[model samples]
Each structure stands twice: as structure tokens, then as C-alpha cells.
Target chain A: MSGDTRHGVGVSPGTAVGPVVQVAPPVRPPDDEPAPADAEAATAQIQAALATVAGDLDAQAAANAHAAPILKATAMIARDKGLAKAAAKHVGAGLGPAHAIEAAVAEYAAQFEALGGYFAERVTDLKDVGDRAIAEVLGVPAPGVPSLSGPSVVVAHDLAPAQTAALDRAHVVAIVTEAGGRTSHTAILAAQMGIPAVVQLHGATSLEPGTTVAVDGEAGEVTLDPDMALLEAQRERRERRAAALAGVSGPGATRDGHAVALLANIGGVDDAVAAGAQDVEGVGLFRTEFLYLSATALPSVEEQADVYRKVLEPFGSRRVVVRTLDAGADKPLAFANLGEEENPALGRRGLRLCQAKPELIDSQLAALALAARDTGADVRVMAPMVATAEEAAWFASRVAAAGLPKSGVMIEVPAAALRSRHVLAEVDFGSLGTNDLAQYTMAADRMEGELSDLLDPWQPAVLDVVAAACAGGSETGRPVGVCGESAGDPFLALVLAGLGVSSLSMAPKKVAAVRFALSLHSLEECRALADTARAARSAADAREAVRAAASPELTAVL
Target chain B: MPQRTVTIASSVGLHARPAALFVEAAQGTGLDVEIGRAGEEAVDATSILGVMALGAKHGEEVILTADGDGADAALESLVALLSRDLDAEEG
Candidate 1:
């Protein structure tokens, strides 16, 4: 086992020891294999491999329907005409059947990435097809472990898109990818799946498969061949966590019975529909940019409307708060192009772009209104990066004109939060985007991992912004909510409620834990807890205060 | 071919609700009709999905196209239908 050192990506979380179970990489030709006597035989092999990949994707999708819609869509592309036919053309070009398949698939995948948006989504599908075809030609199981049958720390050098998607999230305790970034899709998905994953671990592929390992997600560490005692301790911790998180439901309220709406922040209409199907109260932040993210130009008013309708239809009478496009130079669009700047986040983005391009804002507003009218849902629209009351008022007026009932502004800028009263006065509600708020308040770059300490939501400066925003919300009589990562945290949720936030929005999976935490304390207790946290000197001290003040059960879960 | 002018009633017109309505109307006519901004070239109108995909906005002007028996009548009726508010127009 030690000699093999099979390398691939470590996806998911947890550590277990088991036998080697390599999900071999897709079939490919031997370096010295002679030309086949019959082209027909090679063609047949390629076709069979493609069909097999398609079948695997379907099976995986059916098994994990709740995972991500992109999985199913990628499956569709694997069997698409553009891809299948493109591979056949390579055969005509006289490349080996396996080489033909790999070359053609790569071309499309590159094209999709270049195209971005919906097309860029196809990159994973193309990679899947390529891997499978090459594996079939080479006579090996596709790369990565096919199934983690026992508790073991799986090792991998690099992970492909499908390999990452096909991860058995339940069995895998933690993931250590040799080559990947924290912002890579694998990392994002792992975080969303509640699995501790550490990427960019050098020599991950050098570890023997089935070796006992320990992973610390918060620390981004993977310890290979851990002692038996450590494994037992980790397992005990996990089981305790499960018990603590059990029975979380209904609205997230504090011990004193102060009610704070618990909602899910979703990216697309599909996500809205799926999460809405769950027990979530309503959609907290419906990222409206998805409707236009993949488009060559700004989505037409009608295009935006159709999506809004689909998104709102799921929530019905439930409130669906739509956030207008948050794109900027960092997330540039071909149609709504903004030139590069020294700092994309601080540069023209969010509400600033909407100001420069009222037509884009108008189009989004019109669609949202149409969806509201069609679905009869309580729809609300909000603008991102509103630093001034003027921007908020400008956005609100447009939303009202578009025929939507309510409009609000996201207080991501400290200036906006400090003057939140005035900004909220112009809008119907306020939602604090804590991630951006923290970044801006502390003068920290979000992308800079080294500033992770400053970026902590518990940072005094970040909390100060939240407190100011909440106070502003109260002054204006407009309800406020936290829709950033901090809201997903149970202890923080209580503090936010104490700060006068009316709602807490987070990933759907986190709602239960937060709700459970809130139920353990009263509104007054939560207020006291918030004060204790605020009085602390640093983020660490503040975090400790929150933990100490929280109920034993909540503290244990943390 | 027949032509008519209509404001995209749905605030974000032609792309969302207006587009859906236009697609439905073009489908009903059984005429090879096209729709587009007032002065721009029109796309195939019969395909509801395609028409909606165009993303026309509220209060925007769109030209309609069709040919053959009752083509003129179909274009006129469809254009008139498109001019109205879609939510009220829908059954």
C-alpha cells in the first residue's frame, strides 16, 4: 500500500482506515500501442465508454438529487450532440480512437470555460467524458476511488469535476486535495456539504490509499496514519455533534421568545425551488444575477421575468427577497463589461454598476415585478453595495416603478451601515451582507487568505458594523437581516437577533443548527450574550464569550 | 407578413411575461411569424421558448412577422393581443 502512493483529490471530510479502492481514471491508449487494424472496433470502444459515463452520471444524480442541479445538467452535456459528434470528427482526423475522444472533449471543455456562465458549467461534463473515454481505452477503472466501502483516509493527487461530484459525502469524513484552491468549486462544495476539506496539501498523492488519517477543516491540515485513539475521539465528537444538532426546526427564536425569521440564501431559481421544497420559512437572498451571469448581454426584461416567476413560484405567499446583480470587474460580463481596476471588490460593483447602467437595473426590476404578479408571492428586491441613502432611494424608486411591492438595500459598506438609518428610510428593509461588511470595515481584502483573522465575522470591527446597521434598522422601522456566513452560525445568530436583526438567512443545511441554538436561549439572554461578546477585546475573546454564554448543548455543538 | 406595435406590459417585457405571451400568440397563428425590437430583425415567433429567450422588456416596441392564408389576420390579432397586459390577458 505504501509503495503505490496513488494520488488523486481528497474531497469531503472525516478520517477512516480501509483497504485501497481506486476509482481508476478513464481508459486511454498505451504509449506504445500499435494502430488498430479496424477503426470500427476503436469507434465502438469510444461509444461504449461515452454511454457508460452518461449512465454513471444519471445514477449519481438520482442518488444525490439534493446535492446540486449542475450534476444533472452536466450529465446531459456528456450525451449532447455538440460533444458526441465532435468526438466522432476526431476519428475522421486520424487520431487514435482514445486520443480522438480526449482531444475533442478537451476542446469543448476549454470552449465552455471561455464562454463562461451556462456554457462554463459544461466544463465539468466535458472533463467527465474525456476521463471516461480515456480510461476505457486504457482498460482501467476511472481515476479516484469508486466507492469508500470502509472508514479510511483516502488520498489523491488531483480531482476532476465528476470525481469530486461523485464523492460519497456521508462516508468521507474529511477531504485533502493535493492541488486545489480554497475558492475552487471542490472547496466550496465541500464546505456546503458540511464536510471538512483542506486543499493544496502537497504530496497528498504520496499517501497510501486506505491509510488512517485525520483532517482538521478549520486548520486545513491532514494527518496521515493517525493513532487509533485519535480516530475514536474524532468519531465521538462527530456523534455528539449529530445529537446536539438534532430537533432544530420552525423559526429561529431566542430564549426570551423574540422571533427572528430563519431563511435560506440561494443562487438560482432551481435552488429556490429546491430549498423552498424543504421546511425553510422563505427565500432570504435570491441572487438575481444568475439570470444574466451566463448571458452574452444583459438578460432581456422578459428573460429575467421568466426566471423570477420560477423562483417565486416555489415560495408562493412566502417572502422571496431578490438581490439585484452583484457583478463587478471581478465578475465581469461581456454585455455589462466594467474595465479592470486595482481592486475589483472596492471598484465599481453592486449598486455602483446599477447606477451606471440603469437599463440593466430596469430590466431586472421589471422581471422581478412580473414574477411577483404571476406568483402572487411577497417579493422584495434589494440593491447590493449601497453606501449612501441616495443610492438606496434611487434603487427603491426603480423597484417600485417596476411594479414590485417592496425594495431594500444591502448594507455591505460601513458608510451605509453608519448611515443605515437614512438608507433604510429610503427602502422597505435592510439586509446586512456581513461578508462584504467585514471585508470593507476592516480594510481587508476578501481574497487574501492571510487576512483571514481580520475577516472573521466575530471581529470587533465587523460586529460594530452589524450593531450600527441593526440600530439603523430600528431607527427607520425597517426590519434588518444578516444573510452572510455569520448568520449561519448559531451563536452568532443569537447575537444578531439581540442586535435587533429581524431575520437570519444562511445555507439551508445550517438553518436547523442555528434554530436549535436560538431555542436554547431567550431574547434577553441572547442580548446579554451579544453584549458579552461585544465587550471582549479580540475576535477570539468575543468568540469565547459567545460560546460560554450559549447553552451547554449549543456550546457542545460548537 | 404583418406588423404591429405594442408596449411590453410586463415591466421587464418581451423577455419574461411578454415573451411568453408573444410565443403563445405566434404558436396559435400557425404562421411563420418573427418578433423583435421595433427596428431590429425579428426572430422566429412560433417558438415560445425562443421568443421568451429574446428577453424583450416592458414598454419596448416589437415588430411581428407572418405570411400565407390568414397571415394578415393572424398578425393583426396577435399584435393586438401582445399590446395588452399579459397577466390580465392570461386565462
Candidate 2:
């Protein structure tokens, strides 16, 4: 075996070892490639290419009505006069139509990419035009995932969202890319699909196709033609970890028997059902954003209640902590949009947005109450972005008035964390949304990949804030759960338990690892670990300190 | 020159389906049309990127201008288009 190794940032957990098959980037037209000399013929050539691409897209739009808006929009781009005129100008200048088309599209692509956000998303649509047009002119099959014959690790420079969507999960065991970060589409998709992926690998694309490769998503290691001993070691380690997790289930607790409930953080019915199938104790945080985000209409109490019932039906008697409609400027409800806001993060969002439209808040509360009654699930209601004791009291009253079993408030805003004891006095429980809490406390937008350092959950400041919220839970004798994206990490779950978090709620797939991690450490050990973490000066250092002091077996699995 | 000043009525205002549909309608007019936010430089209406780049929000005023034989007709058509909630219309 040709033993070789490389490292990159691993965005998803687990390990994968298979033959490497590189997914080639879309073919680019040569920059200096000359166009046809005859201006009239070149014009017709460009016109024909555009027409074919537009027709193909139109057909695609028809075939995929759900995607018609985006596909048809791209088709319109193919027919836009600006592109045709730009191509014609180049043809007139003695450049071939291909060169002209490339240049023309580049201009629009550059503009769209620069606009960022919404316009930036449209860059893919524009570039889709270029790729299809270029493919038509070149007579090459449209660049996309090539049919694979067997399980293989697909390596690439970068996979466009379309290409990623087209990827055959049956054939690709893992994705290795040269240019992507944790926040990139590839990483996000990989996480969603529960695939092990290593991104930003420097020479990922250069790996020869069909070479046996092994990827450790946790370690972010890529090994080419690995020796059998190394492969066996990875297999045995994985088996050991799986076996340990398999030995334990039910509510999470430590070796010394201090109770820690391992719960699921669900978004909608699908998540609830999937998590219900796992060994989780109950739903700790049920995000109600999907109810509002899914459609244009402000759902009626009956419609909302019906969906909540479906989600709660899966859990039966298990507790489902349902968060009220959390529509914000970022995730705007078509019917309840407050128009454009310059600072959406700081502006009307979550509880504030719902407050702006009391009907939205009222109907959602009524739905949760009715759904809880219909499904007979142990339901607890919560409000997101509650920054003050008054807001908490208001949310609790609404939940109580609706006949909900209990009430809670999310600790996302820094203000909520600082005065959490007072806020907790008003609600039945408090859950730390570490993702948003990290963002607000660190003064960094979690969406911005460049600011990931400050948004790291392990950051001492973020942990300190979480500890403060948990302290509130103690003062009020209400359970505090970690329901952010961070709770999924086994190490972070341990740290959360150490900080007095009563429940660990995360994606269901992560429950096993966290459950096993909890069994390896006692509550006292967790507190000591948290103390070591809080004393650390940096996120990386805190993680290392915790890992250094953690049980040897636990650290190995982590 | 024939022109019209109209407020954007689409809920999302000149973006996504609304923006693309707006551009397609403008292209159908044949007569060259330019659109811009009030007091801002107008750009070619036929270009979706250019139109969306205007970032015209709901209830915000935008200026649409066109020239030639059907210039007034073009402006009228565009004004009518912007005055409706294009997003609610069936695709």
C-alpha cells in the first residue's frame, strides 16, 4: 500500500475509508481562446448556444416545477439582451462568440458575487448559464456528478450546490474538498446527510482517482492507500466507540449516577419522528420556525395545531419543549414581514417580531396548547430572544393562559444571560441557545465563517455566559438544557453538564456519542473540567484543558 | 423620453421570482427600458442582476424610463407590473 497522509478541517463527525474518485470542477472556457473570425457566423454561433441552453433550462423548469422559479429565472438570463448584446459586441471586435459569451457572463457573475447575500445566491444561477452555454458550445456533457460504480470518497476542488444536490449518496462514502470551510455548502450538506467530510484539504483534487483513501472526519485526516494495520486500527477504534455507546441508553448520566437527561432538539415533524426513533429521553427544544418559514400564509391556529400534533404524536408522553414561532428578519414570514431592517440580528426578530404581530404569537400559543391536548405529549412552551424578566413573564402568562403544561425562555440574548436569575423567576425553565448566545456574547455573527473563532462554543466567554444561564436555572429550580448546535459535541456536552446544564439536547445522530461521554465522567469531574475550561484564556486552550483532564477512554472516543 | 415613477408592490420587492418576472416582462416590451431607485443611477431593465442590484424594497419608489415609438406604452406596462404583488401571482 502507498501510505500517505494529509490534513484538513473536518466539519462532520465519523470516519470513512474508501477508494478516492475526484469530482471534476465544471469545465471553464479558455480565457484567451479566440472566437470565430467571421462576425456574422460568430453571432449566430453564440445565438444558437444561448438558445439551446435556454431551451434546456426551460425544459428542466417544466420537468421540475418546484424548481421552475430558479431554473426559469436562469433561463431568462440565457435570453437576456444584455448577454446577447455583449456577445455581439465581442463578435464585432473579431473575438469568437464563445470568448464573447464567457466575457459577458463574467461581467454579470462578478457583479452578482460582489452584491453578497441575496444577490450572491443568484451568482449560481448566472454561472449555471455560463456552464450550460459553454458545455453546449464545446459539445461536452453538462458538468455534474459522474455515475459512480461503487462506494468511493469523492474529492473535488469545490462542489457547487447543484452538483452537491446531484451527488449520489449511495456511491459517495465521504466528500473531500480543497476549497470549503465549516460554513460552506458542502460542509452543511454533509452534516445534514450525516456523511463524514474533510474540507479545505490543500491537495484534495490532485489525488489520483480510484486510490484507496481513508478519511477521519473527527481528526480531519486523509490517508491514501493506507496500510492494513492503520485501517484495522481505525476499524477497531470505531467498533470500540460504537460498542461503548451501545452498552448504554436512556436518560444520560455520569459514572457516579448523577442524572443528566439526554434529549433531542427537533425543528419539525421529521426531526421529531427521527429523534423519537433514537434513544433520547424526550424533546428538549422543538424549534417552531418551520411552521412559519414553510409557507407564505400566516397559518391559522388549527393548521398550526395540526402540525404540532403530528410532531408531538411521535413522542407520545415524552416531554416536547416547543419554542413559539421564532420568525426574525433573517427568517422572515412572507405574511408577517416587517419590511427591510438594516440590522436584522439586532432588529425585530424572534420574540420581538412575534410581539410586533400579536396575532402571530397568539395563534402559535393556542396551537401549541391545542396540539399538546390532542397528542397527549408532555409539552413545555418557550419563547426565543427573551431579553428581560418582563418578556419572560409575558411569555409564561401566554403559555399558562393557553393551558400549556409549562413555560420557558431561551437564553440567547446576553442581557437574558446576565439577568437570567430574574428571568428564570418568571418562566418554568431556561434553555441556553449556545449558537446564538455565542454570537451575541462574542459580538460576532455566527453566520459569518470568518468570525468562527469568536463564535466557537468553547470560548471561555461563551462558556461563562452559559454557566451564568445555568446558574439561573439553579436559582429557580428549573431545568436548563443546551439546545444549540454546540450541544451535539460530546466534549461540549460534558462541559455543559459541568456547568450545571440538566439536559443535553442536540441532533439525534449525536445523542449516542454524548450519552457515552456523559457515562464516563461524574458531575464533580465535570465541574472541575468546567473550572479548568473557564480558567483557560482561549477556546482552543479550554478544549485542550478539558480534554487533558478528561477520562482517557472518553478522550480517545471524543 | 417616456418615464414612470412607481412604488414596488411585491412583498419581497424586486428580488427572486418578483425580480426575474419583472425583467422578463421588461424584455418583452422590446423598447429599451432603464430602472433605478429614486435619486440613484438607473440601469438597464433587461438585466436581472442590474434590476435586483437596485435593491428596491416594498413601498419604495423606483423610476422607470424608456424611449422610441412605444416608450410610453413600455413605461405604463412596467408601472402596472410594479404596482402588483408579483410574488402572490401563480408562477
Candidate 3:
């Protein structure tokens, strides 16, 4: 073998070759740390260490406006008088300074965990603060992403939001994490920043810090000590991919002139503004959860409308398909949480939560209607996690009552996809949320990194589901589109188009490649590729079969 | 001492931004303020850790007491802050 190769989930598309730089995990107090001979001096040291951490975080906050609130809050935690007193109490009880800090942090962490929900989530922020203080007390280097000296592939167990936010983007060429699913913070941030990233790589942090490695983010492969020939090939492919992407622009179309609306999937106003400046037609997925996730109370309709307006104003008359709040399970809103469940994925979430609390959906629909009227944008509202025709009808009636033009439902539940003909009859259109669809179809939890194989969008079963949903859409004369991670994959985009998906929505940066991929194939050729993939025995085989069937020019760049 | 009883209006209760804002406001006041559930042990209102550890939730009742200069004015202002949904306001 030219070099040892490791596999992971390719979250962000691209390639990079650079030396590895491992991010150090949070520091722990030494088990055998001895008690200080002078308790007063120990207490003083503990206080000073916390203050230093607070000061450092404050400085960092001052420099990064995007991360300022988070950093400032962490700094505030460091300077808490209650925390200081707790540590001092531990010091008086004969624990070393570092040990005292750990005990104090654990005390508060236990309280936060006991509180549960949003309070429990704060425990991570608390622990980060504690780790920083402990590092200072022990006179060790701070834990988390270190300052990069040059372009490097950074490896870590899992990157926290704070760590990812603080990364030296200019010098960090690629990211490999031992843990994190496709929807994890690291994966989302990497995709948004357009950096090459591979997640769920086992033993990723074990690579020698200075060892040269080649990261093929598209292939989810990391090769140690890559040979000169492999590196040269990667460099040439990078150039060729760029040139190919540059050559193709404007609205997406097949070689035969079959139209495929390429669009962006955005979460909020900032994402909308950025995506609007790109070459895509308009937003295909507008996730509205960001407004409610952070709020302790539901935002007023006016407040919601203002945010929606900002998101819609960018697209003008272009279509912006908005998905109503998708919460519960992985992302729980404290205000709207439906309590704990053994199986949150299958529990009351998305439209189910909306059904139980009609007021929530009512307010959201009202806001979307208001924003649509004000901005004059072609706004279409969709409900997530709809499992039945009745659910779709119920949502459609509400959408009409709110005066919104078009109503749609996300065909994520297999039941909905199976009966989509009936479901689509009740709505204006449909969109496939392939991520959750695959998760539910394969009986795999999307959050379980170990089950990534089952969650792969290339699985023949998932393709069948997509084809079934498309058949339903065609039967009802309703357009169906894909607004999921799979839509961003160039090869998969063609497959979706072949399955009769009228639109493909992905990250703004990924739109170009998918658009270019479509430009190389005719509708007939895409259908042939789709048929070949669906006939395969396994996900890997399906992918290989499609790759083998695709035009060589198209596959070369990918 | 001036005391006021107010129900937490924030949908998330007295936590996160509300807790931080409440603590900052309490600290800005030159009075010694304490907050707690009725008939429970009170914590320093100016301490963010203590306030967050209180584990207060939306629609829960809290008792605020302050002593020293401008105690009445401080308690009144604090009560006003707690009456609104602080989390709903834009940053």
C-alpha cells in the first residue's frame, strides 16, 4: 500500500494535504495532586488562575464579534463569586488548587445537569470554563484548538462550538474529528466556512502532530505519508474541479435542456443574505428553528415577521420555501419541549409538537403570511415530520387560513413517502428530507455515528423511497424537491433529478458543483445512472455503480 | 429592607440571557439584593452562578429583597425587569 488509509464521513467537500495538528483535550486535575501546605496561598492561587482565564476569554471575546457573547458569558462564569467561594471552600478542605477548581466545577455541573433541558446544555460551557481555569492553575497550555502556525489538518476528538469558532480559518486547511455526526456543530460549521472536513474518524487524534497527511474530504479518506504521485493527482484534480465549476453557471439544466431549479438551504437571515448573493435560483429550505431555540418565550408575531422579512427580502420574488419549526428530539426548545422520551426520534416532534400546541404553528404561519405580504416574495410554507394525509390537510388548511399562497409537507417519514400520493393531494408540493428519511427508513438513529453506514443517502432503500415519493408527486402533479445533505452531493444530485425531483437545494458553496454535474448529463443518462444505482446490492456498491456509469468528465472532477 | 414578589416571565425562566441580565442589573445597583423562591434559602442576586443555580423556570414566583440606599427603587426596577419576557427581546 502507498500509505495507510482511514475512513470517515465526508461532511464538507474538498481536498487538502498538510501536516496534522492535534487539538488537546480538556485538562484534568492530577489524581495524586497534594494538598497545599498553606491554605491561604492555595486559595489565592485558585482565585488568580480563574481571573487570568476570565481576562483571557474577555480579550478573545472583544476580538470576535460573532463569538463575543459566548466568550463573554464563559468569562463571566470564570469570574463568578459563587464559583470562587466554592473553590476556596474546597481549598480550605485540603484539596490542591487545581483539584479544588475541579470539585467546584463538578458541584455546579451536577446542579445544572439535575435541572435538565436547556440548563443541562449549559454544563458544557461550564466545563469548558473549568478546564481553562484548571489549565491555568496547573501552569499548562490551554486546552482546545491551539493557534495554528501554518496550513494544517487539525484533528480532534470532537470540536466544541467555542473551539470551532476560534479556529484559525486561514491556516487550518482541513478538519478531522473522532466524533460528530453530519448535523453536529463541527460538521455544520465546516460546511458553512467551506473548509474540507471529515468527521467520525476513529483514532483521529492519535496521528503524530507533525506527520504529513492527505485528506480527501469528498472520499472521506485520510492517508498517512501520502506518496508524491497521490499528492500530485489530488493537486491536479483540485485545479480541474475549480475550472469545471467556473465554466458552468446560471440556472441548472441537463445537457438536453431539462430544467432543474438549483437552490440554497438556509437557516436564518445571515445565511439567506449570503446565499442570495450566489448563483442559485432561491432558497429551497428555510429552517425557522433558530428564532425559537434560544428564546425562553415565543417571539411575538411581529418579531418573527421581521426576521422572516429579512430572510425573504434577499430572494425578492424568487421562491423561499419555509419549513415550520422542527424542534424536539435532538434540538429541544425549553419553552416548547414535550418532556423526556425514550425514543425522541419517534416521539412528538416537528408537526406533532405543533399539533399538540397549535398556538405555536398558528403564530409561525401568521408570521410567514405577514412577511410574505410585506416583502412580496414567493413564500411557500411547509411542515416537517408529517406522517399522514390528514396531517398534511390539517397543515394546508391552517396555511390557507393564514393567507399563505402555497403549502407543502416534508416527506421524511416513510409512511408519508409511501402514501405521498394521498399526502401530496392535500398540499401544493412536497420536499424530501433525506437525512431523517434514511434514519427512519433504516431504523437507525441519525445521531449515532456508528450507524452512519445505515444512514448513507446512497443506500438503495433510500433511493427507492425517493423514487416512490417522486412517483407520488407525479401522480398528483405536485412538484417534489430535495433539501438535504444528499442534494449537495454532485453525483446524488443527478440521481435525484433522474427520480423526478424538480429542484435541488444545498449549501450555497455546494450549489456550483451540483449545477456543474447536472450540466454534463442528459435527463436520459441520469435515469440510466439512477437505475444502475438502485439495482445494486449495497450502499457502497450503489455508489460505485453510479460512479462507473457517470460520464468520465463529470467523475474526474469529483 | 424592600421586598417584591414577581413571577418570572421569560419562557425559559430565570436562566441564560435573563439570568445574566438580572445579575448584571442587580450588580449595577449599589444595594445588597437576594432572590429565592418563597420560604426557601435566598442567594445573592448579583451572583450569576447563584441565580442560575436557583433553577427557576417560567411562570415561577420569586421573592426579591434588597437593603441599603435606593433599596425601594432597585427592587422596583428589578421587578419590572422580571415582569417582561427578557429572552424575547432582540440583542
Question: Tens digits of per-residue lDDT for model 1 on B1-91?
Answer: 4566666555434543445456656767777777777666676776433353345645667777678799889978887776677644544
The lDDT for every candidate, in the order shown, is 0.71, 0.81, 0.90
True contacts kept of 1: 0.00
Tens digits of lDDT, candidate 3, A1-558: 359999987878788999999998888899999999999999999899989989988887776677788788888899899999999999999899999999999999999877776788888888888999999988887888766779999999888776786777878888899988666667767776777899988889889899998998878899999998999989999999999999999999999999999999999989999998889899999999999987767899999999999999989889999999999866787678788878989999999999999999999999999999999999999999999999999999999999998999999999999999999999999999999999999999877766777888999999999999999999999999999888988888999999999999888988889999999999999999899989999988998889888889987887
Which one is best on TM-score? Answer: 3
Candidate 1, RMSD to the unseen true structure: 9.7
Residue A478 error for model 1, in Å? 1.7
Residues A1-558, candidate 1: write the lDDT tens digits. 122222232323333334333334444556665555576776677777777766776776677655435455445445544455666777766667777787777775665555444344545555766776677667776655565555544445545555766677666655566665433455556656666666667766656666556675543555555566766766787777677667666666776678899898999866887789877789888887666765555767787788778878888788888899898877776578766678898889998998898888888787777778878999888999999998888988898788778899998999999998899999999999998898899898866654656777888778878999989888879999989878876778888888888998877877777888888888888888889888889987997788777888765544
Q: How well is candidate 1 docked (DockQ)?
A: 0.05
Off by over 4 Å in 2: A21-127, A130-149, A156-163, A179-188, A205-210, B1-91
DockQ of 3: 0.55
Candidate 2 has a TM-score of 0.76
Report the number of the highest-lDDT candidate.
3
**lDDT of each residue in A91-117, candidate 2, tens digit only:** 787776666777788887777655444
lDDT of 3 at A130: 92
What local lDDT does model 2 show for residue A504? 79
Give the poorly placed runs of model 3, Cα more than 4 Å off: A1-9, A17-19, A27-49, A88-103, A113-118, A134-141, A160-162, A168-171, A179-185, A200-203, A210-213, A221-235, B1-14, B21-33, B55-91
